[model samples]
Target: MTRSVYVTGVARGDGRQVVELGVMELLTRQVDRVGVYRPLVHDTPDRMVELLRSRYRLVQDPATVYGMGYEEAAALQAEQGQEALTARLVEGYLRVARDYETVLILGSDFAGTNLPAELGVNARLANECGASVVAVIGGRDQSAESVVAEVRNAHHAYTNLGCDVIAMVANRVGQGVAAEAAGALRATLDVPVYVLPEEPTLSAPTVSQIVDTLGARVLLGDEAGLARDALDFVIGGAMLPTFLPALTPGCVVVTPGDRADLIVGAMAAHSAGAPPIAGVLLTLDEKPPPHVLALAARLAPGTPVLAVPTLTFPTATELFTLDGKLGAGTPRKAETALGVFETHVDTAELTGRLSVARSERVTPMMFEHALIERARADRRRIVLPEGTEERILRAAEVLLRRGVCDLTLLGEPDAIRKKAGDLGISLDHESVQMIDPQTSPLRERFAERYARLRAHRGVSYELAYDVVADVSYFGTLMVEQGLADGMVSGAVHSTAATIRPAFEIIKTRPGAAIVSSVFFMCLADKVLVYGDCAVNPDPDAEQLADIAVQAAGTAARFGVEPRVAMLSYSTGTSGTGADVDKVRAATGLVRERRPDLMVEGPIQYDAAVSPSVAATKLPDSEVAGRATVLVFPDLNTGNNTYKAVQRSAGAVAVGPVLQGLRKPVNDLSRGALVQDIVNTVAITAIQAQGGDGDRPDAGGDGQERTEGGAA
Candidate 1:
């Protein structure tokens, strides 16, 4: 029988979507083939189902997701009675459950349905389906005591109906009272209860949603601007001076068609990167002249300009009532939702209560999710040297928004601020710390330290002072001086420039021979470690062995079991050459050094990865087909092979993660994306937490790692 989890709410407006989405995230992190079934839905399309299907890449047909429409179900219940209706629902649910390893049953919304006793119906369905219950209670505008009482009542109601209530969630509670509500519930109930405070971003409507709701004509803005959340609305009947002060970040400006001056001023202000608005909503179906509108477009290229037929009062009313929803189009809102859910909820404890066995396959999404969760667990400070770069700044926004780690961005503070503002990114949070490397008070101290560390090779303090002003050196110095835990650089600079400071300042670990690198190749099913990819060109046999040992330790540190495979052009004794000889020698050295490690050498790529090839080539070797760590003979082969796999196989390559360093310092490719930078920063923070140890048993069969490249 397939394990099932039924997510239901006590009443309307419980914001159970967050709980549902969070549960889906947890499920995807554990297993791959998870299914979703909505017992009853409104006449219109299901936004939550579309979101789950898109985000998790589910392949289930859309027609099979729902058992019946709300009206049909109500009619059937009224005419044929309750048992007949439930039988149909059970049959539809089993159709989905039979095909998936686990299924998530989404309960009906308490809206637009004549079905009586909805909660009872949901409870009965859960019992009939043999599904565990996760009850959600609405806490909006409720006191801590009231919320706790409601949760207790909900738990009992489900338990009395013969439902196995596994967990209780108090969602959309007041900000300060989440802790209070959770504490009260924990004191009273034996089951785990989590409280998620209300988030404005998740509730605010996007510009696109407004357009759809009001039937507005969009004259400007791209898809990205349309996705911006309209947190607040500014009614622009006042003059420019009075109106500019009222304008705020992520606010949409609503004005009549004749106020071209206000429109131009607002667009100019947005272009200047102060108080970036979401878009402009023009009322009475009026738009400015083509020339003025063109000027506004020039001022803010991606800012939206919308025209609606309704007047200002009616438009404002409609806009105020429109709430943002989580769906296929609103990805940023999904991120915000997940961030809010993970921050407040005890996910580990909740997942443990679910009793879902971990799957052996580790997909790319699972690996990335695990990275963020692990980095967020023991938060560490990481410094980005290229703070002024757009990708770095965007990545910083995601990191801060997700509460992944503390960040110290090294650059001129003013320039970084301007760039972030121009890109509509807010860096005003407490977790984001920006520093000017040249003018910082710590520059003198860093220079003095750099001079002392390099005095044997150089002579003057002034030279060290100039050298320390460089951002890479400054960031590395910050990590070395214990100001920051780790550093990730090289988005715009070369790999040599990024890690040279680490080699000079942080140096190698005491037992380590040399600093090496590994790229965590995230394939469709599993993650593999490729060593010496970005460092060490043509390493000798001893260096190769050292790289292998360091890579194995790094692999273990992340979660991959270290089954080392020293790759060559040949497998076993079939071929002989200088390259194969060096690999064979390195294999012997790795065994001699770390006898406990499982290692195979002089193995072809096919034999190392493919079971069929391994059976034909070397059937008896334990590590032949099951190798999780592949140590390339040299940088030439390693770099090319990683890129080939990344391009050819659509793998997400997440590093050039430097190993054997006393402190964690990683480098990115020059063309790294925002997500790549985010992954690298998370990896660096995890490395700073410890060097060589087993991570918590969170992910799948092997350790998952990351490096930033195209997938």
Candidate 2:
């Protein structure tokens, strides 16, 4: 569904760009489609318009999202009550959002002193389209008192309008202010406080938010409206009726059949003689009270009436008991934002995660969606495992759907379609290529690539084609020969099972020999990247150096630059053995080969990673502590250590997001999670976009690049 966002406070040019994309990132979390509007702009000749022109595709007129850029706003200083002007410019803002599931309404930076007709009308328009308001405060100062005053004032301001202040967030504050600001907001505010950490900025669209917003449609609830900002006002119909008092004027939600009293009382209290009833929600196969409906018809006739089905009123009521408190400053703050969004958003949880734990800038020229689109190829061949026809088609053709990748699914046309129907995945043969290996044009191509390698061994061309084609090896041949840009397999195959075919055909990328596999071990909020899992069973120090370099590069591409800690059982200058020696040698080799990289090893995992241990072990080393990438001396140490971490610690292990093939070739573990498949597929698509000569999707073909998955 397309989402329309009304972002305000984007006065500065860069700040405006940041929010434009930031809002897009926020919407990408839930809404697949987007239409952004700015009912008004402060100033500067169409900065918003120019920004829109330079950056995003429009679902509506870009001018409507923002009117009167810097110069224009200044030009029309006398043009107060710019409703006609804004409405004229924003041609289809309402029309576009009218059909959308979730419309994101961004608040202008009026600072509460401006007229509501200008701001309130904009906010009210969101309600007109069944949208919610996400109000972000651009902190002009660090004085804690100022933030408190502003939030309290705004809360009362919005509350008096009979609108629930859905969420509260402080933006542009220095990272230092997070702890105290969050604390203050928690103690003072009745709602959750979210710190849009100084990291993740506004570069990429947040997939988590996109998925949640989109999936909210499936929920059976008393009210099915989105919270523009979960940190603001919260009113769950099925939750504990704890918000009875907050239901003054702007917002009130109640199950029509279950809580007739709430519906009647809230409406009576808020809309006496046509007071502002910002959001009047009725849920569960029920209608408003007859008298309440009669009263509403005469009073706030235009207020949005939200209705949802499925959940029982009492079961739904349990949600309102949440503390809604802001958390202390931590890396998980962003994760918390995601968590909070999931709970409050009317969408399904975005199970897919681009694991990032710290604050950093997202570089330019690399866009996640564009890459997803670019990975969709129109004329590509792919091999699908027997019954995975549905997921395979969905994933393989993400590029094709978005005009990115050419998808090929390896299966019989009838069989694949039948399987898709069984799995409840709507797929047509024309949408994707269902190539049956038993009889395909690539049959001969596979025979040629396979025969060139396996001919000496007693194998006929037809037999070679059949054998290679049936196994994933032929898929590898397809990728190597440019018939396909990448390959995703291992649904029914083991780690080694998946890589064997790719290894035989895909070969390693340029500049490296050793193929290493790394597992993205996410222990909830913390992400641990461990390498040398799949490929090099026994790697020398030089080969280990390449692996470390490759792994670190991969980490950086996913927006996590590597603080590499080359792992061993020992610490700095401690144990002496072939193992430790190899690790130390690898450390030296990495320095000699890629000195710009952050690498330190020949240490225990704790000593290499934790600051506490590092202080005692390698006090002055750059990468001794807080390492992002783990470089293992050999396959045994890399694979076993990662596996131990995955099983014993119960980490959510995501493989090999990257495979350093000539293209984006990645192997899936036999028992991989659906999330794992989604993430790896995304990574592969990104990597594939980087290699496609037809388009420079990455920074001139900039996307995540992988190396050494041992295959």
Candidate 3:
């Protein structure tokens, strides 16, 4: 039988979408094939369904996702019979259920439907589909006791209708009452009751949503600016000085068309990064002159500027109805929604109730999600040396928003703020520390320490003081002194410049022979580890063995079961040469040292990854075709092979994550994307947590910590 979960709300404005998104996140983490079905949607192409489809990469056809429109279902229930309405829904649901391991049945939104009893209808549909129920009750404008009573009543309603109520959620409760409500509900009901406090950021409308509601023209801004949340709205009727003070972070400025002064001031304030205004709304169909608009663009290149025909007064009134949505276009809200939901809901307990089986293969989305979750479990502070770069700041916003880790961006405070202002990014210095290495109180201390450490190499105090001013050196010093957990740099600098500080100060771990690098080749279905690709151009047999051990440890740390494959031109003595002999010696060293490890030697690429090729080439080898960690014979083969496979197969090569460092320090490519930086930082943080004390590979434990990038 296809196990299914029905997410239903007892009242309007219950904020059930967060619960749905949370459930979907949990389901995808647990099962490989999960489908979404709506018993009665308002339209053929529903926004929520599309959001789920895009976010989860669902393959279910749109026609099969919904049974009928709400109006049609209402008509059938009113004219024919309730059973007739449910029969059609059941038929569509069963068809979807047949193909998926689990189905998330989206219950009707009680707002637009004219059904006689919405909750009763939901209960009947859940019962008919043989699905478990997760009832959502509104807690807005209610007392804690009242919210608790409402949830208990909702649970009873579903249970009385023969629907198995797995959980009762009290959503959108006031700030102080969520705990009390959950406590009260637990005393009254036997079912699990989760309380989610009201999150304004999740409900705040985006600039794009406001533009759509007002039929406004987008004068300036890219998709990123349009997606920014409008947390507050400021009406610009006063002078420039007065209006500038009214601007808040993520606020939309509303003013008449002739108020070019207000427009310029708002744009200037955003450019200065004082408070990032969401956008400017020019009312009364009024627009500034061409020169003013061009100046605004220069001030804040991608800040959204909108023009609407509606005047300020009525437009402000209409803004109250526009709220943020969890959709494809607004992915940040989805992240916020999931974060809020995961923070509040007891997912482990809920998972047990749902009986969702663990998946066999970890998908790419699942891998990324797991990385974030695991990093958040034991949060660590990570330092980024190239903090003033645009990609770095953008990636910082994403990392902080997702609650991945505590970030300390090392740069000149004013310069970083100015760059962020030019890019229209509001980075809260309080939340993310911004330090100038030259002016820091620890500057002299770091210089003295560096001078002492390098005294044997005849380093002078003057040189140490100047070198400590470099952000890379300063960041690595922070990690060495335990001021920060780890460091990620090299977005603009060379790889040598980034890790040179680490090598000089932190040094290699006790048993590690040398520093090597690995790139996580993220294919569509799975992630594989390719080692020694970025470092050690021509490692000898001893160095290669150490590289294999470190690469296998890196793979295990990131949740890839390490089946090490030593690659060369020859396979199992089919040919003999210097390179082949070196690989064979490295394989022997690994087996003699770590007998518990599954390893194979001198295998060709095809035979290492393809089962058919492995059967013909090395049939009895345990790590032949199922190798998760591939140790290249040298850097040239590793680098070229990884690039070829990446380009040809459309794989996401995540690293060149440096392994065998004493402390966790990784470098990014100069052209790394925002997401790539975020992943590297997360990997660095996790590596900090899995320190060099035990050295999981050398310990021979074979334990996997998480699902993430190389090293």
Cα lDDT, all candidates: 0.87, 0.52, 0.85
List runs of model 1 lying over 4 Å from the truth.
43-45, 457-459, 692-711
Q: 2 or 3, which is superior by lDDT?
A: 3
Leading candidate by TM-score: 3
Per-residue lDDT tens digits for candidate 2, residues 1-711, read: 333444443222112233334444444433444455554455533344443334433345444444334344333434754554445434545654555444445445453324434445545554444443444555544566665566566556555655444555555455566667767877887755444334321222221222242232221111111211122123545433564555432233435445656555554543342222334444465665567566644433333344555354542354233222111211122223332332222221111121112123221222343223333332333434433534454444333332333456676666664434322233442546666777777678778767776565666776776676674766666666766666778777655666666555555566655556677666633566788777667788887888888888777665466888988888888789888899898899888988898788887889777899899999988888788788777776677777788789777666765445445567777666554555566556666655422221221211222223432
Q: What ranges in model 2 sit over 4 Å off?
A: 1-404, 429-431, 456-459, 523-527, 647-651, 657-660, 691-711
Error of model 2, residue 64, in angstroms: 32
The digit string of per-residue lDDT tens for model 1 on 365-397 reads: 889888998999999999999999988988987
Q: Write the per-residue lDDT of candidate 3 for residues 1-711, one digit (tens) a residue.
A: 799999998878888999999998888888888999998887768888888999888888787898898888888998999888888889999999999999999998888688898888889889888899998988988999899778877777788889899998888899998888878888888888899999887889888888887889999888778877888999999998777888888889989989999999998888777776888999999878999999999998888999989878999999977877777877777777877787888878998999888877877777776777788888889999998998998888778767788889888887797676555455764558998998999899999999997897888889999999999999999988888888999889887788778778776777787878898888877889998887677889998999899889889889899999999888898999888999999999999888999999999988899999999999999999899999998888888898898889988788778877767889887878887898888888788886643222232211111112221
Per-residue lDDT value at 413 in model 3: 84
By lDDT, who's the top model here? 1
Q: By TM-score, how accurate is candidate 1?
A: 0.93
What does the lDDT read for residue 267 in candidate 1? 90
